[model samples]
Target: MSLLNGLPAHVLLVHVVVVLVPLTALVLVICALWPQGARRLGPALPVLALVTLASVPLTTGAGEWLERHVADDPLVRRHAELGDGMLPWALGLFVLAAGVWLISRRTPAAQAGARSGAVLRVAAAVLSVVVAAGAVVEVYRIGDSGAKAAWHDAYSKTATRPGDGD
Candidate 1:
């Protein structure tokens, strides 16, 4: 039930979101741009999007809980703020993925070649690509801030200076 003996579930869960969201975004962009890929992906893109969207809240909730117990350092505060900004992008990706999937499914196969329907699909695909790109960027931003907050100091201390012991 607890991650590493109550070691803040966010520490563990953040990795999942970090990996899954970007991977999903890449696949989503591919599926959006390529009909063949979309046919192959079927429901996977939407499902992945949903999973990524769900993880946002879980990670943030765990992070929020941990925030109280940890040092009130500016790093942690900034990380929390960056994490909050990710939710909307994640939700947007989910909605876009769902819309693309629904549009693909509802549009009759026979009519998929029709001019207007084709245009609609193309438009949806473009939107999905844009939203997925945003989600990817947001994830990177969140992760980078978190890494800086968590490891910058530790890593800096370990780096050997040019004139050390000289």
Candidate 2:
């Protein structure tokens, strides 16, 4: 069985990663800042993080495969480079989500302890916020670059077609 069955996997998987990663980041930030929200989300945050993390590598691998089959242009290369940088941010958000989940699971007494009480919770929240912010920014960067690479030339060509007015 062929891996992609003659289709470009990148075209199929990029959408999932693009949508899920930012969504996960937003959820992570919300859970971090809101205790009741975190309680309601329960196990969902970590699971979302895991899925987002998994999707990144898949999207990247597909992108690499697609890259090999396409002409090397500055826009595509820039998008590829930006895409390669996404894994770390995705991984960081995953780690932060896991950390937040673990911290939230501790007992009331354990959370109230001197070392692991309010201070730890605050620290986790702050760190989660920072990581979530970074992840969101990275997602925007990747999406913007990818969109530009994918459409810039097509739009340019269309605009410059014969008999077309400026």
Candidate 3:
């Protein structure tokens, strides 16, 4: 898993984490807040969350491997530190998503009354929103750090060809 097609695997796997984590978070929030959305997407929410959660480790592991192979720099080290924190957020999102899905799937006869169901849904919705927000922000921070690490000195202000004026 260290390399893929002669490129660091992190280069490929990070994209999956980048896309799916936010996508799952958005879907979890939507399904939590809207009953119609819950009804339509509840069954799939857990699956999506699971997939997103799974991607985090694969990405970070590949990132760790790449980090070891590359020259050590403070920016890259910072990015790696931030990247290590993603798993917990992803796990929280998955747990909340699964909880929301289970709540959404409750049968009418299985509940005490509509009032209690609404209360549970609202509570779950609030928690989901909070967790989703945290997850998204963490992703942004990790991505920003990673971008800086990758491109901090990759180019100058002026664009130049390989042999311009050389």
Candidate 4:
């Protein structure tokens, strides 16, 4: 129910994805402005694009693995569902990252990409804010729900034993 128990080794990388995927995209967005500078930075947008894309699968896989062990309470399910809902968020960011990469590299296409980048950057900022807020709400909701569920299960089990009376 806490970070230690809630987050496990198997899905630890998933947490990394949640944090890093956006990070890379944001960085790429900045780098997109200076293609020459971005080129000097590292492997380029293709690699960054792949890394961003990889997070989607990694996050999903890790979450599914974690969910298997966690109890199927609504609160827990809600958290899992939250992750599911973010699939689109992650996908959009990845797409934007890819576009930024292309625009930065493609001189002829840079104008269109720059326009798209402007829009993408704004969208990224908005989504980042929204996602951060959503994560907080989901965490709080899931925690409260899990606590209630745990208590309910404990109470029911206590009352159902042969020697126990409600």
Candidate 3, TM-score vs. the true structure? 0.91
Per-residue alpha-carbon lDDT of model 1 for 1-166, expressed as tens digits? 2355757798999998999888878877777777667666789878998899899899998898888887778988999998999888888888877767666565466546688778877887888778878888888888888988888667656547677564
Each prediction's TM-score versus the true structure: 0.85, 0.85, 0.91, 0.53
Error of 4 at 91 (Å): 2.1
Clash count list over all predictions: 0, 0, 0, 0
lDDT (tens digit, per residue) of candidate 2 on 3-92: 376778887788888788879888888887876677778889999999999999988998998888888889899999999999998898
lDDT of 3 by residue, 83-134 (tens): 9999999999999999988887887565447788878888999999999999
Best by lDDT: 3
Candidate 1 off by > 4 Å: 1-4, 106-109, 155-166
Global Cα RMSD, each model: 3.4, 3.3, 2.9, 9.1
- Over 4 Å off, model 2: 1-7, 113-115, 156-166
| TM-score of candidate 1 against the unseen true structure | 0.85
Q: Which has the better TM-score: candidate 2, or candidate 4? A: 2
Better of 3 and 4 by lDDT: 3
Between prediction 1 and prediction 2, which has the larger TM-score? 2
Error of 4 at 129 (Å): 10
Relative to the unseen true structure, what is the C-alpha lDDT of residue 117 in candidate 2, on a scale of 0 to 100? 66
